[model samples]
Target: MLSGRLVKWMLLLSEYTITYELAKAVKGQAVVNFLAAHPVPDNETISDDFPYEQVMMIEPLNLWQMYFDGASKISGTGARVIFITPQGDLLPYSFTLVIGVYDHTPNYTRSPEEYPSAANSGRLLKGKVAIITGGARGIGAATAKLFALNGAHVIIADILDDLGPTLADSIDGRYIHCDVGRESDVESAVNLALAWRGQLDIMFSNAGVAGPFGSITNLDMDKMKDLLDVNICGMVHGIKHAARAMIRGKRGSIICTSSSAAIMGGLASHAYSLSKEAVLGLARSTACELGVHGIRVNCISPHGVPSEMLVTAYRNFFGKADMGPEEVGRIVGETGSLLRGRSASMEDVAQAALFLASDDAGFITAHNLIVDGGFTSAFSTMSFIYQ
Candidate 1:
């Protein structure tokens, strides 16, 4: 009897092989026929016969109005340039200024005295309201802080009553007890954000649990049920209620947190992987439904981050309570990776969520932004080839 994972992989392999072979065969035949009809003699090429070229046009790269501020001081030396596009897009660029022994030519003309920073930087999410599930800790916590810093009125929703209120208070945001497994809790959280801010702009459905692990033969049905309730049904509740509130505004961004295992098999437990995969399908389906109202739906699948849940999983797996983030990151990198040297971080995943929430990604929707550092792009066996 084949395992469930094996069955899934087999089906995927068969479908991919069939489609790829058919496409390759058709293209090969077309190329052969084309060459037969338009035969070329040896050493003959189009370069000599058609020795023609057209003059290229060049335009000034100044579509965005530039704002520059250069300063030098004992504290720091840097130059900040801000570009505001006609469409009201903001781009803040910071560069370090260094004056070395090559004194004849200084990079900057200004004298070292005054200090300058991006104190007047434009807030990407100004005047927006965001509700982040599982915001008390982990990726959701990072995202909540980032959103608040970017000028969004954030509402932290989580079951961690102790930490949730504290984080919310620090960010000047509100906190509500929300066990995503319950539909009423999710609906009420959305309502609270709406009531306080008068509208909902971003919804981050990020609460999830790593379900039962180990062999499929010993899989626990009770644990599987609980996993689906929080991971799948919870996300559904968020999307359903958030979309309703966003419809009133006619514009919003809904982001869900998935796992790298959702796209690639064998990276996580069966229940956890399945739940994350369901999130992608839900986002794609709901995006189509809410697109008319200008509500964008998307999900982010991040590779191993040293979250509380991940740390606990690592300790449980290795039976070592002393195992820290560095050890877990090294193990994950060795097991599955394309890019080396740096492991995926919570901030990286949060930045993805922030981008999708901001107007910079206004045209993006129904997309699964995988933040795996090229792990999904390369075959697992390719590591041996490089060695």
Candidate 2:
């Protein structure tokens, strides 16, 4: 008999977990204190059916003390939580939770002295409307923010309605819950975006998955198919519909999220690499055919952008221990390139997309920008270095 407030807290916590796995980082004592802070209804009794002993054994006071002590350390650091049920099955309670003190700055606070204001920076996309899939976080969120800051009305499409709206609110953009893998949902999202801004100028087909990272010899066929449906077919659907809309409007830009793995072999699992290669082909062919209609089709093959998909892949395929996401990113940055010696960040990829989206790159069509810090080139020179 969970109280309504307890249920609400659990649900919120669960939602947080879905977006990240740090919720699992909350120790037993922290859970108890959190529960105590938002106590259950007076007459309600908690269920004894689950693993109560493991939970009750936590030291509440110690946990609260640790949380406060570590508040600054964890602030703005996205941590995900994963929960397992007594039945030995994985639960869907993965979410990113930020642990930190609150800052209540006024909305009209002056821009930091270091940054330039809109008045000083020329607007590259003054009257354009852009749609970004999976725009709630990671690369998608960064792209949305970049577009809005550059004077474009952005439509943030993501399945995480909460994060999407929060991100949009921060950028003065609009959010729509869209699973881009679903055709109907995508259609609705496009319609919604057009209704808000009267026309669509850029469509970023960036949502994708690495799928379950395992050798082909032992991988699940069903999982492989699911990955293809979302990674490959999803991009295809986005291209098809985006092209149709752009043809009607007589001008547009379509950018897909291909990967550096697409241009080379052995970097990722079989399906992920294959899907990205397919995306490249799709972008090239669409660019050729859609060129007549004034729509530019391009792909950005970025390397190691600290995305959730890449984090999962590192843990799964590399058999790496749970070094924090940042640590994983640092390792990728070191190993990904010889020239820059850093993995491409979300900002790097967004900048590439921004250039392609803007009129500055108007002549750039059917182009595949390898934003991989010379990864492809470095790999080719590996034998020379050894010699």
Candidate 3:
């Protein structure tokens, strides 16, 4: 039983709220402001930093067509169209902002006849040789399989010699026994790869251990040292050997697997978090020293990937007798910001590693690509509820 004027005002307020939320979702405030200040002119070529502009015309329908068609031509120039409503609502669309690199670049567009297939995707890594440590199971195994499927000659190195050979046979990769914590083992693994493939294009130093789970006050120093040796020391040895081989070749990619525990405190045991933090630091130092040799070093900080290690640690920490992998995954999903309401899969981490090792990410180095389902950004202490 509201008045007509009150209903109208409420409707207008609801529209504004929806617009604000949409803007927050896509992070489009800067783009909207940029468009507002530089209105588009009819039939006039407007050259801007990002190569797209918003046109305001008296004729909405005709201007929409003109904008769409004109934007199509700019797309050939690598620019894209973004639509904004009169009510300050922005429509969602995929767009590329062409900068200085588009000056003389060829305007190539894919037709239906030239579309990609699984066979073409497999060719993306043709002739490339990749070495993956701890490649027997979990993320390492997934990465090895993906690299093989993408046509890279893969070498699986792990202390678990039994599983390593089995996994290699399944993935069409070679196997080598490598206890990454030992410098000699790492050196031998590199030698094996060089002897077999005659070249190594990528090195994935992913061998790590979670160690014993307990309260920091009651934690065993010996257990902590063991974890550090395998996790941190292992990475050091891997980097040393990988760097030597990569330096000799004068070009390569080195990827280390860090964890989301490195970024946020209190997410894991003290030793585990320290080990991951050290891994991130190692990536930065390696990138600095090896950039001269055209070697790219990067790290992936993955969150909530289902693994036997995670399952055991959670069960031990909470003293839950019957907790399983699915329950652990559910707990992580609740803690994370997945809009789809699911935990991150091993394939997600594998894909991130693949990109870092691929030539597509050539210019990217010394960065931690966090694939955490928005955990780090979604919550802040200064929010109203927290305050």
Best by TM-score: 1
Measured over all alpha carbons after superposition, the RMSD of each candidate to the real structure, in angstroms, is 22.2, 15.5, 16.1
Q: What is candidate 3's lDDT per residue for 76-109, written digit by digit as tens?
A: 1112334345664332212222211112223233
Kindly give the stretch of ten consecutive residues in candidate 3 with the minimal lDDT sum.
Answer: 2-11
lDDT of 2: 0.68
| Cα misplacement distance, residue 186 of candidate 1 (Å) | 0.5
Task: Report residue 189 deviation for candidate 3 (angstroms).
Answer: 0.8
Highest-lDDT candidate? 1
**TM-score of each candidate structure, all chains considered together:** 0.70, 0.66, 0.68
Clashing pairs in 3: none
Give candidate 2 misplaced runs (Cα > 4 Å). 1-121, 317-321, 380-387
- The global C-alpha lDDT for each of the candidates, from Candidate 1 onward, is 0.72, 0.68, 0.69
